[model samples]
Target: MIAKLLSATALACLATISSTASAQSGSGQKAPTANPAQPQSQPNPPSSKPEQQPTSKQPTADRSKLIEEAVTAVRETRNAVRAIDQNKPADAISALERATGKLEIVLARTPDLALAPIDDAVITYDVIGTVQDVERIRAAAKAAFDRGRMQEARRLMDGLASETVLSVTNMPLGTYPAALKEAAALLHQGKPQDAKRVLETALNTFVVTRTIMPLPLARAQSAIEEGRTLMEKSNRTDAESVRLGSLLARARDQLRLGQALGYATEKEMSDLVRAVEDMERRTSGKQQARGMVEPTRPMFDAANKASQPPKSN
Candidate 1:
């Protein structure tokens, strides 16, 4: 009975030992599988910070190119003026068109260019002048009494005249409108040659008003009208005796106009004075040439004549 009991105890011990070994092997296999899942939960290494990008700026080079193009256009316009003076109308027109194209480009690239305002004014003046010249030529080419051409010419003249009047009238309160009105009236009356003369005088008056300090441009217009009346009377066949008188009257009117312009405003009178001087100088030269006087003598006489007092109206 004691031996059987001891054998039973040994068998029990072996069974327990076998069970413990099996449990240890299962735990070892489960640990590896659990480790892989733990790896998924492990936080990823911190990501590196993203780099920044750069920004763009305005192009100075583009601005310079735009300015250069504008300057080139101005030069081309001057060339066109020269061509017009030489009576090459077709060439002048072509050059002016090219200049206009370049100016358009300049405006597109740099609308706020500093010289844009002055350029616009110049363009308006030049284009109007050209339009007037072309219309005058077309009218002259038309058959006499061709109502259609005459009407077309008159229409164009009216538009230019209205524009001129409006330009002057829109100026500051002190600016004169009389000269502009007179020029418009002359153009409307189908007197383009007379209108051109009036317009020239008006331009001078405008310049003078900006410079001198007393006489208004309206006064100059009145003087020009008086001169025109005298000129018309001198055209009569029986007016030979009064031709010299008429010429003298016209000279006096111009002198009065110049004097008025000389003292019109309160700005810089130098420009006005220079313009008046140039006109007087040119008129004097023409007169001397007509009298068959020596070039030097006529020039001197002109200078002296311009300095003398003007005759009464």
Candidate 2:
């Protein structure tokens, strides 16, 4: 009976070992199946990468189109001014309106276009011809100003000033006198601030110095006088008055510019003094002439009678 029991125990142990091995094999197979599902979870294919989207590039071509539009608008405006000079008022007005509209579009699209080239072209083309195209721009600005279009007037004046400066840039020193004359008009029109700014900018050119012996000093004095006159005529609260203050500040700036350019020489200073004296003499002469024109016969007779009677008494 004991041997039979032992044999039975050994058979049971063998059965248990077989069952454990089968369980181990089943688990190993499930692991591979789990790995297959993991690949499904990684649904993103190599073809579906984030970089596959189209890249947004710079709109260089678009910018070029805007610049072309701006250039065309400037040219059209210039042509319109020429028509105005030929006494074609209607045609000129119509063309100018169209040009203004085109420029508006360009400005709306791209406001920061470098206008130096356009400005240069406008002045060069107008000043050399009988067109007086630049004058038309000034007229437009004046009309705008009269109509309470302050911003519009400012824009037009700025454009005009820029163009004038550009035209004189390449000219010899002799051209500054004429340029200053043009600038003076702008100043007289209550745009003294603009005049000062333009003169300051034009003085940057070496040609201006090459032509005038004491170029920097002369410019500084002129700027200072312009500022002083404008300030005297201005009301402190008005925009134009404020601009006059700016002109005065710019005059001081021109003095500094003269110093920087080495144009502040003894001769220049002497010339400045002489100019001041001449101006004073002219002013005094005019005052004297006005006094002489006064109607003072009655007062003179009264004074003469009083003196004669006092002597007789």
Q: Which candidate ranks first by lDDT, i.e. highest?
A: 2
Each prediction's total of clashing residue pairs, residues at least 3 apart in sequence or on different chains, is 7, 0
lDDT of 2 at 197: 52
How well does candidate 1 score on lDDT at residue 188? Answer: 51
Candidate 1 error regions (>4 Å) = 1-58, 114-313
What TM-score would every model get versus the actual structure? 0.21, 0.21
Q: For candidate 2, which ten residues in a row score worst on lDDT? A: 19-28
Model 2 / residue 285 / CA error / Å = 87
For candidate 2, report its TM-score.
0.21
Clash pairs, model 1 backbone: 212-264, 212-265, 213-263, 213-264, 213-265, 214-263, 214-264
- Across 150-184, the per-residue lDDT of candidate 1 in tens digits comes to 66544433322100100000111122233334534
Candidate 2 lDDT tens digits, 201-225: 5445322100111222333344444
